[model samples]
Target: MSNVLAIAGVTRILKDMLNDALVFGNVDQVMGTDFAVTAQPPDRIVSDNPDTQTPHLNLFLHRVTPNAALRNADLPTRSGDGALQMRPTLALDLHYILTAVAAEELHAEVLLGYAMQLFHEMPVVPRESIRTSLSAAELAGLGSGLPDFGTGPLSPAELADQIEMLKITPVALSMDDMSKMWTALQASYRTTVAYDVSVVLIERALPVRPTLPVLTRGGLRDPETGRDPGVAAEPHLATSVPSLLSVAAQDQHPVMRLGGRVVLTGTGLDTGDAQVRFREAGTDVSLLLVPEAPARPDRLVVQLPGPAALPGGSSLAGTPQDPASWRVGAYEIEVILTDSEARTAATNRLPLALAPAISATAVAGGLARR
Candidate 1:
């Protein structure tokens, strides 16, 4: 009778072999029976049994037997000894068995592949084809047996939508359109736009590092000796408030509609009762106060009425006899700000030019000419 030894811990040994194979490249001894078979060492010999110098190699053999109905003959009786009387079969190779196990556990195969790639420096195989190769039942049970593994939160469609929304397109604008936009910006606000020629002149006259007013915790510091001899000090002091001025124009020709806010920055000056006057070009003395804001020192808020129409009976023809034909010229109006001391804290003198309103008839004629 052939003796067989059941491998008590083959599963754990196999798992260790797989883990070590991922960490180390040598698999020479892993394939040998020495790791699985339990027996005396090869160097040891039995003293009483000289013929059996080395111990017999214990082997674990497994075979699948099929059950079927037997004919009317008497069946074999069980042996009195607790051993089976059935014939034994050879076991399959461990590597082949492991391959079969991986095929049976598809998710384990994927996880093994990923682990091998990470630990063994193996090339990665794409997951899509592997997923497609799995059967419906196998795919359903892939991650279900695992206690903590989870399918991701976002669906493929949602990811695709987010990716599509991330793409951006740039918008382009022409110079004339940009100018019109700036004009609209100024027209939307009631504040005056003027050329600060005085600032430009002053900047040209002053040195690179100019003196400014000094403010201290105690109060304003004395100008002559504000710092100790050994201490470093700032070169410039704050004096006049920086102001920006520019020409303002109606965004749309004929000023059909207009209505937005003006931002001003300054110090030591009150804008209480600040007024912006708009006048016909070329006339200085006869100017109309277009808008006015009640005393609010340091900041002024103003609003201009909308849907302004050109002066009545304006003509496009440049005839000197026609008041409308006389195009608007420079130095027409000014913006003035008054402080508590009744002083003119800030002033912006603006030069303006008004273009003659174009009529529908002229547009039609121009199209005909074209």
Candidate 2:
């Protein structure tokens, strides 16, 4: 068989051993009552030399179960083997161990020693000792065919160092070790049926934000008054604003609430018609609002609800209030602005704060004076 195939076979045997170990030794520990084990075969193999008789294989072991109890257990309690089970909650731990054994320094030495033993006809020489005695071209030629002493470039020490750099420690298993582990496992489980095992490790990806940009408002004039909207608008006025902001986010159907005070301001904007809404954003939350008619040239201000433990910070445009000190859970404010039609031009969204209570207070305080 080809060296690559041999490596694959070795991995398969090792995985089977692991599964048997779990099943027989500590069926309760490894899989609990409801879990199932699956085997994923080697996807690739790497050899130290092109003509080397042995190579290393990569394998995956996967455990599947619908048991919520098992899923919720801590890492230490979740392994397939009861006594031997390490913390199984973290999938990364399995990957680390596997990678360490498969491609790491420990395995590299073991594989090299094993390959030399297997290929009795080929001369076995340390890579470093050979490198010192031979030139690059000579070493290349030596590595091409039957191994010769003093012809390969890298010394054993240097090769070992390179293996260390690769962070290959002690994860994968050899065929013999695989057999031993499997024997122990099968005996423990008392199962004669063949089983497949596959192990997968995955990292959760971050959520993506919407591609659409926030809407903008351009300068426009009042047709009835024929005055610059800026001049005619009111300042520091409260107007009722809608609570929801992004329509796309709303599709998630997040629970909404009036999180804090909602207000609108501009030359002519008042506090009556403005409304505000809140929705969940991952672990945190966001607020959106729309101001009433009688739009202003100046920007509008929206504040997040503050908590008592205000982190020594406040909103940009409003007065900071201690969230804990306030007896009321809900507060409302409003702003009146010209309808979208009345304004010569404007964008859809008005900026709002998604900060903590203290930060929101700091922000509101800063913006209130502007």
What's the TM-score of each model vs. the native?
0.22, 0.19
lDDT of 2 by residue, 1-370 (tens): 0111212222333433333443454433422232222233222333344344132322343223322333444455323544533333312212211311132234333432332232233222233432332333544553422233223432221222111111112334556755665464442211112222222122122233335673433346557876544533435444323222322112132221224434433432332334333333232333335533443334344543444355655453333333433332222232333455543222234333333222323464474321
Q: How many clashes in candidate 1?
A: 7
Q: What is the lDDT of residue 339 in candidate 1?
A: 48
Roughly what TM-score does model 1 have, to 2 decimal places? Answer: 0.22
lDDT of candidate model 1 versus the reference: 0.30
Name the top TM-score candidate.
1
Question: Model 1 segments beyond 4 Å from truth?
Answer: 1-244, 250-270, 279-282, 290-327, 361-370
Clashing pairs in 1: 188-260, 212-237, 212-238, 213-237, 213-238, 272-295, 273-295
